[model samples]
Target: MSATGAIPVPPGKAGKAGKERFDAAGRRVLLVCVAGGFTTLIDQSVLNTSIPALRESLHAQPAHLQWIVAGYSLAFGLALIPGGRLGDVRGRKWFFVGGLALFTVVSLLSATATEPWALVVSRLLQGAGAGLVNSQMIGTLQDVFQGQLRARALGMYAVTGGLAFALGPPVGGAVLAAVGPEYGWRLTFLLNVPFGLATLWLAARHLPRPRPSARDADLDLVGLLLVGALTLALMLPFVQPPGWAGWLGFAVAAALLLGALAWWQRRFARAGGHPLIHPALTRSAPYALGTAVAMAQFGSSLAAGLVLAMFLQDGLGLSPLGAALVALPSAVAMGFASAVAWRVVARFGRRTVTAGMTGSALTMLTGGLVALWAPAGPLPWLLALLQLLGGASIGLMGASNQAFVLRHAPAEAAGVSGAILQMAQRIAAAVSISALSGVYLRATGGGGGHRAAFAWASGVCAAVAALAVLASVLAGRATAREEAAREESALAVTSNEPARESTRASG
Candidate 1:
């Protein structure tokens, strides 16, 4: 026995035991994280398919109808940073289970919603719960796995997310069709109940509880409040009726809220308590640039879907079922792409990012041109091609950017870093959808001019893709620097290690 009241074992045997324990823990953590991700998929996809049914049943107007979707998205985005911080401050297991419980309860409430407002509020709560669970997943993975294994786990995580996105719409539609509209939308939300309960039970029984590290800090409540206020202000314009006064008020609030939030974060950081986002992490070139790319890519993809769905239904006179079928190829492509993202990243590094973004930009530009010149001709094939191209691009850029961010983040700050990235993405999605919807509304003369609206929406996609290209360029440079630093560190460590002969002789 060692002096510290511990038993010392043979080095080989100890290493074997530790390895076995680590492998077991890693598998358990992966299972829990993947389960959480699956639920999030259900929540997101179910709502998307049920939007029309929700509108019909609740008698929701266009502006109000957007809330059915945007409400959940907004809440989910706003809560991400705080959720991550909570996981860091508390333990991951509690946050994970607590989030799942909140989600399950809210999902039930959503299923029971008879009024539009009831559904909206329930969706928001559901989003909040999802935010808590999702923001902790990457951090939990980092805590459980390391090196190549971590990369593989992340790849699998991406694959799971892709599968959820790909399957969500069709499944939601199938459930709705089977049960009838009265029960269809409700089932989408209610379906999450069993899955959530199962996750909670399995996690409690099998997941290893991680101890709070000494390095963990207290929650940054002030920073969190400020950021939350800023996000809410930004999303308010999208949800409210459009008027000059309303727009102006929201703009002013957003500016003030963001300014105050920035100042408070700086103040908090200087005061010794951790800020909601670690300044050092955000200040890193890779982190900052990677976040920008992530935001634009995800935001643009979501906006494209929203706008395209509208165009298909209104302009092409396609049914919701028909449009979803047309869109299936892209979604399927995205799923396949996610599965292979690890191989792509390992082979091409950041070049994969640049290429993907460039491809997306070209695809959007081409789609817009084609739609404008030939709106009625070859509609299905044109859309099919566009979706395939877009899906491939999203798969490459989305997973690659995530890997890039994780590679650069310090292990301890993974939670907060992921939170910030997700925050940017949410804000971007909210703002883009609002702005694009406005553009489509104006172009179509308030929903009557479908052709013009589709053209305008295509234009927005092009602009977003262009912005992504710029982000890709910056990401490329940052990746180069990171690779150089890694090489230098490796060399330094190798130089400092004792000679092999000397080590062997001493042993």
Candidate 2:
């Protein structure tokens, strides 16, 4: 009804107006969500450029340096599932704000820290906050968007991330070079302060608060502990240069803790309790396969970047800014590739991912060969070209992989799925960086073995890419079959519902 007590606007017009309003709201929400993630991404890139500067200024040991790089990732990976569950049980709004606030404070701590251990501890805490922030951002997206809108939002998420990757190196290098070596690394962390506050303001103003869960439901604290313990045990050996015996001990502990986590969560949920992450997610073939692929992609890529950074800065004597310039072309190509990724996914499905993995494998192999023999002057261009190809491979697969994983996840477990995806990536990153460092250290004999180190790292990346190809193929087949079964089941239920209702009314 109109205010004049006459016929309302046409039905089509009304719907169109409503849709436009909804879209406006969605866009604002998406910006807020992406902003939260942007801070973390910038922090990641800036820190990478500052690695050598930190080493020199703090007089940090090899182990200390590794912790500085890997600690936050380890902590973030461990906290993600539990943090997501907390948001599901509590309200996401407060959790998001809390996480951002914590992140800001810790960023300051990390920036101001005078000692190596202090910086490491602050980074660990910052990672935990980041895990919370990411879980909430993803959950918020799932809550607000549906169908085509959801797909677009997720694609935009990937694009924003790609842009961040492109921006990180140049931003870090510029800041580092401007501030000089002593204080440049600190500025990287400090830069997050304003962005964090602004994001928090937008989130509070625009994002809706998630409804709290039922009173009886809560996160499985014991399961979270077990998962955390398992993560810590698995990560410890990697960061600290633990030998074979130490690795064996930690591996055993990790296995035991993992088994315990599974058993506890199963029994808890059987008693009508909420598990940290639903066991059904584990049973989802698409999620499992996609997660494996994501792990490989992140691990190989992060390790490759770290190894290359080392080669450029330490081995080749290039300044941070110079190295960033050399790496700029790949990042630019990646941003462009990511912009069109959703279209590729819509058209090609899982085959696109397989192709990307194949490209990744070839590029890494080529990079390895180049590292071994290519001359210095033309070497940067060749490496840039290989990196550009590799970046495209990553952009093409990553968005689709995430979408596929989320598509199969239950609506109530949105937070869990997001956490699991991120956790895999971060864990892979932490472990891979450590492993690559070991390879570099051994190959260089404590000096300059840039070529050998790069060759070895690229080989590992190629192997991972090959495995990813197999995983993506298997997952695509499984997901197609699963979708078909679901459609049939839905149709069956729909057909039977009318007859059942008729029978009930007659009775």
Most accurate candidate by lDDT: 2
- The TM-score that candidate 1 achieves is 0.85
Which portions of model 1 miss their true places by more than 4 Å?
1-25, 179-182, 210-217, 241-249, 375-377, 410-412, 438-447, 481-507
* Model 2 Cα lDDT, one tens digit per residue, 65-140: 7777777777777777767777777768889889989999899999998999999899889988988888888778
Which digits, one per residue and each the tens of the lDDT, describe model 1 over residues 1-507?
A: 221111345867856654643367678778888998888755775566666667678887666656666666677777777777666666788888888899999988988888888877887788888888887786777667876677768767766766676667667666766787677878888899999999988778766575776665567778777776776676666656559988898889889988887788888888887787787776677778778888887777666777676677556766556667767777788877776765676566677777888887787777767777774758767887888887787787677778777667765666567677777777677666666655664566454567667776877777887888887787677666666777789888888676865788899
Clashes of each: 0, 0
Name the candidate that leads on TM-score. 2
TM-score of each: 0.85, 0.88
- State the weakest 10-residue window (summed lDDT) of model 2: 1-10
Clash list (residue pairs), candidate 1: none
Alpha carbon RMSD to native, model 1: 7.4
